[model samples]
Target: MTGWNADSIPDQHGRIAVVTGANSGLGLVTAAELARHGAHVVLAVRNTAAGAEAARRIGGDVEVRELDLARLDSVHAFATGLVSDHPVVDLLVNNAGVVLLGPRRTSADGFELQFATNMLGHFALTGLLLGALAAAPEARVVSLSSITHKSAHLDFDDLMSERGYRAPSAYGRSKLATTVFGVELDRRLRAARSPVISVLAHPGLTRTNLTPRAWEHRGRLGRVVARLGLLATQPVEQGTLPQLRAATAPGVRGGQFFGPAGLFETRGRVTEARLSREAADPAVGERLWAAAEELTGVSYL
Candidate 1:
C-alpha cells in the first residue's frame, strides 16, 4: 500500500471529533488539521483560556471544553456534555497525557498522577463516550501511545508505582498501559460487534511542550533543552501524522498501530509501528483493563 500522510486524509465533512489536550503540541496540530479538513473539532483541554486560544489559532468549526484528565469527575462531565450537545461523535481522540514529573503525586481520586492522567482517565473517557461513538455510522477511537512503551513493563503489583517511583519508569508504564488498552479495546469492540473501532498511534519523538514542561518544574537548564529539542526534532505538524492517519485514513483497521517510519520510529512517514511483546500480550491487557475499571468505576466491553 502507498505511504500515508496528511494529504491522505479522506474528506471528513460532517464528522464530529473530540481531541483531548488540544490546547497545545500534537493534539493542537491534530485538531487544527481535522478542522481544516471540515470536521467540527472540539478541543477538550484542561485550560479553557489556552483551549480558546488554540481554537482561535485553528480558526475553523472548533469548540473548546474544559477537561482535566487527572480527575474522573471532570471526565464524566465532559462526556456527558458532549453526548447532550453532539449526539453522534465520529471520532474520539484520546490524546491528552502527561510525562515525567519530579515526585509521585496523586490525582483527585487519589490514584498515581501519571497512571491516572495518562491511562485511567482516557479509559474512562472512552467508555463514557462509547455510546455516542457507537451511535455514529462508523466511529473511531484513536489512542495516542508512545515509543517509550517499548521499554516498559506492567508491574501489576506496582501499577501506580506506589511501591517506588522513578519519573521515566512511571511515565513508561503509563504509556505501555495506554497502548495495551487500545489493543484490548479493539478486541472487545470486535467481539461485541460494535461499530466503534479502536486504533493506536505514536508521535515519533516530536518536540512538544510536554518534555520541557516536565522539566519546567525543575529549573532553567531543563527548559532550555526542551526548547532546543523542538528546533532539532521533527515538527509538530509531522508528529501529528500518525494519530491523524489512525483517526481518519481510509482502509485503516481496528487494533492497528501507526508511527513514524524513520529510525527507531522517531520521525518520518507514517507506517505501522512495532509493538513490544509486553504491549501485544492480550492477557496483560485484560488484566490492566480490569484494574482500570476498578480504579475509575467506569466499565465497558
Candidate 2:
C-alpha cells in the first residue's frame, strides 16, 4: 500500500516483541509502533540510557534490556535474560546493525565489525532464542536487509575483509548475508515443518543516524553528505513500513523480501520487492549457513 502507516498495524495484545537497536532510528520507530498496537516490546540495545529514554517516549509496556550485537558474550547474556523473563517471544526483529568507516576494524571476536554485528550476532541470538520464539502460536523473525544488497558479493575466502576493506561494500555484504540467512532459515523451517516464519525487509533510504555516525570521522565532505542526505531522505517512521509489514502483515509469507515501492526501491510505499540473484542462490546460502555456524558456533538446525 502506497499510503501504509503505523495506524494500520493489527492489534498485538499479548504478543511479545524483541527489537534490536530500538533506541533510535528505524528500530525505534518499529518498536514504538509495535508498542502502540498493544504488544509488550523489549528494546534490545547497547546503550541502556538511550534505550530507557526510547521506552519512556514510546509510553507503553516497553522494557529496555542490555544487548551489544558486536559482542557474542553480550548477545548470549541478553538471550538468557530474555528467556528467563519471557517464556515465549512472538516476534524477533534483527534490526541492529553498523556501517563502519575508513579502514578495517575488528569486533571483539576478531570478526569484521559489520559482519559480526549485523549478521553473526543476530544469527547467534536468533538461534539461542529459537525455543522462546517457537513456543508462541505464530512466531516470526524479520531480518533487516537493504537495497544495497543487490550490489554485494560474498567473498568467502575473505569474509572478514582482512584482504581489503571498503565501507559501503562491507556493509552491503553483511546485509546480503542477513537476507540469505533469512531465506535459508525459511527453507529449513519449512523442511522441518516448524511453526516459525522467517521474513526479510529493508528500509529504503530512511533518514537516520547510521549514515552520519558511520561517516562521522570522514572530515567536512562526509558531514556535508550526511546532512544533505538526511534532508533528502524519508522519515524513519515511514522507512520502517516495509519491515513492520513483513513482521505483522496477514499475507506476508516466509522468505518474502519487502522494500519501498518508490523510485529504484529506494523511497516510496511498502511492497514485495524482487530479490537479487545472489540473494536467491541456494548453494551460496547453504555455504554461508555452514560458515556462519562455524564462525558463531551456534546452529538452528
Alpha-carbon TM-score of each model against the true structure: 0.96, 0.97
Per-residue lDDT of model 1, residues 15-118, tens digit only: 99999999999999999899999999999999999999999999989999999999999999999999999989999999999886678888999988989999
Q: Write one digit per residue (lDDT tens) for candidate 2, span 1-301.
A: 6666778889999999999999999899999999999999999999999998998899989999999998999999999999999999999999999987788888999999999999999999999999999999899999999988998999999998877688788999999999999999999888988899999999989988888776657789888888877777898888999999988888778899889988898888888898889989999889999999999989887
Off by over 4 Å in 2: none
Error of 2 at 76 (Å): 1.1
Worst 10 residues of 2 by lDDT: 209-218
